[model samples]
Target: MFVLDANNPEALAECLKELNWLAADENIVTLTIPGAGNMNCVLRVDTGKRRFIIKQSRAYVEKYPQVAAPEERVVTEAAFYDKVREIPFLQGYMPRKIGVDVSNKLLAIEDLGPANDCTVLYNEGEQLSEETFTKLLEYLSGLHQQFMKNKVDDELENEEMRKLNHEHIFKYPFMVENGFDLDTIQEGLQSLALPFKNNSLLRQKVEVLGGLYLSKGKYLLHGDFYPGSWLQTEKGIKVIDPEFCFYGSREFDLAVFIAHLYLSGQKEDLIALVADKYEGFEQLNRSILNGFVGTEIMRRLIGLAQLPLEMNLERKKTLLDFASKLILNEKI
Candidate 1:
């Protein structure tokens, strides 16, 4: 087990020096842990005076300087953070960016607390009760409403982002490389009563949904709004991790939330619950919410957030069978 050594004050001080943090000498502590970070080192540095998280992308040498400029995802995310800063709901949700070191592709932002907490939604799983559901829905509704109202005309920019994000992240090659076998997934499906005829159907559904969604245009998306992306505190639920942030179909965010709900074992009456809660909100229609749900489920089943309903093989088969039936028979 990898324990985060928060006691390493010397190492924290050295990291501050290396990153050129302009703070007076004070007791500094390192509070980052080992986990699944896509392409950055997430660190929490706390001085006696202030606390902040340092997000630094590991540098890669340009083998051919003319071929490609080193990608700056940190820079991209920082810019995105500014774009969503005006959102009152997200003000507490996102960590405030305080400093940047573009040379190292590093950024510093406000630290939430304890540096990190294990209260992520996914980790909570089926234990998430009615209270948790209420909190999650509230957060989702606020975020979706904000994005739906945001008017922006930069479609081309979002298209470019789609290329970098969806195409690259959800591409077939990555799935194969990541040890996910299409054949095995298909076989698992076949064992179910409502098995998919071919794996191609998955891709087909994604393409259809993607095409329909593109026509709807970009809205602010918390690209990774799964349960793990949220925090419940005394104030309210705080959403975090804007690293995967982008401008795209608002449904993408909704889909991830729905997926979390499903994984949390709230799949039985999901449609009714979502409809009741979402349609009751101002400026939102049942059609729009249902449309979002349909597109989101299709996207998550085949896209980057390929979350399984159950981990056990037999249970997975049963869940897939039920899911297939729902997708085929249900209106949403």
Candidate 2:
């Protein structure tokens, strides 16, 4: 029931001290929000001795308070952080887990200083370098390969979190009347989106993919592996915010990553290279993978979770058209 309040540093410090995260000698200097906190209450806590990032998940999303989310989601992320403890490479790409307060639903981690997320890729003419993507894709490959199970286990099912994601990604976007106006996001978007949202066949395809997304799978996923989750730090492309993570289709993660690449206007070669570079790409179900990819593309363009994409209506229409075909299993 302990909520993180930025104005009340004293209470936050007291909470940290109680959890043995803030040492007795360390004094809280400042608490600043380091980045766009879409899901949880995140702050960079600077103590006299050291600095770290702390996240607290409440009953609702931090950015959209009306949207309800599981309060124990951060605890699930802590579990993911612990699961990856064995993989040094993955740990290198992610923040070091400092501590977790299960009762209070708080998590503290190493602060990758003054970093910006890959959302900047959404800017005009920006391209993700092959070098940066090597590390990023490698992390994805490793996570899937290392943690893949022969049989699905009950651990980190994260059912509540998955259902919350299910609504936004699959269900919310296509609804005829969701009460959100797309034109508010971008002029002519609603009109551009009308055909896709109204198409019964496309909706069925998206619905099938959504079912697949919710089904338990063998591989571990970053869960929200879009550009926003990939942070560009001084160290490298460090990934963060795995609060939406679950044991699901690896394709779902790759799909989201690739969808963003297309959404951002990254070149065709880079997209092709991504599929080739990932280990076990040859063995992955192409239908399911491409289905997920199309689903992601359609959702981002027409869905509730819109990105900061620098796109014209014509470009969006083109992407939406392509996404529908991909979902329909038509040739690229």
Candidate 3:
């Protein structure tokens, strides 16, 4: 149940107005719970015959004015989901977008309350059955292929994206700049100091990422892909939260997905597990896993959104150590 705040009704009302969904008979109730992100409030609206999720975007999330809602990107999201529907292999892994109120940054998505979070699938000691895993791999592989097939070669692109990926996600995270808290991570570890001390190594990784990204053939990639972004239901698995999706390497997405699996300790033979499920996967996806896996680990570690495994030092010391070792060994 979502606790009603004074502003929630107003927010919902505004969103409905923006979406042209403000019907005299429709009843909308704001949820007491907020989503994990900084910019949105989730609400469940019962239209009697059906229900929908309303995500209202916020402007001043954490007093960051520049981080306003990317209303224009909502169009991108809708187009992506529409394209997702066309792929025969990915029929089960995407949601049917109902409507979008881009001006309000409000999205009306298919009600997924009845579906179970995929994280619960792992936590319950039930590995995603081979059937589901195989389906997922095929969907991902096909999605990447379709993305490449759909890209327009002549469109002029903005450099802001590249700058964001490099500066905010990579460079700023590792540096002891005003935005980052370097001492917090460095306090207990001396061996890990080599990364911070050697600027050349950091620059090399950045250059490597740029080169890998430039070789991209895919249309767009979900920069962040983990179980949390998926929900499994009786029908099948549906992916949500494509906010971080961008034009980049297919290996980048695959690596992040694998690392998330490893971090959760869901499977021992990671490559073998994915390889078995994704038929002829090696031909399509060789061990590009080696480079980006560590890059992803470090990106999550020191970056603004560090992994939960790194912060919870007590219970997940082993996981943290593993991540640390990967960061060191891979020099990410």
RMSD of each: 6.4, 0.9, 5.1
Which pairs of residues collide in candidate 2? none
lDDT of 2: 0.89
Model 1, stretches more than 4 Å misplaced? 1-21, 34-36, 58-71, 115-125, 147-152, 155-161, 168-179, 182-202, 212-218, 233-236, 267-271, 279-310, 325-332
How close is every model to the real structure, measured as TM-score? 0.69, 0.98, 0.74
Give a tens-digit lDDT track for model 2, residues 181-297. 999999888888888889999889889999988899899999998888988888878998888888888989888888888998999988899867898988888888888888888
Q: Compute the lDDT of residue 233 as modeled in candidate 1.
A: 54
Error of 3 at 132 (Å): 4.4
Model 3 lowest lDDT segment of ten: 154-163
Candidate 3: give its CA RMSD in angstroms: 5.1
Off by over 4 Å in 2: none
Best by TM-score: 2
Give candidate 3 regions above 4 Å deviation.
1-6, 14-18, 30-34, 57-71, 88-91, 115-132, 150-165, 182-199, 214-216, 233-236, 284-289, 310-332
Ranking by TM-score: 2, 3, 1
What TM-score should be assigned to candidate 3? 0.74
Worst 10 residues of 2 by lDDT: 22-31
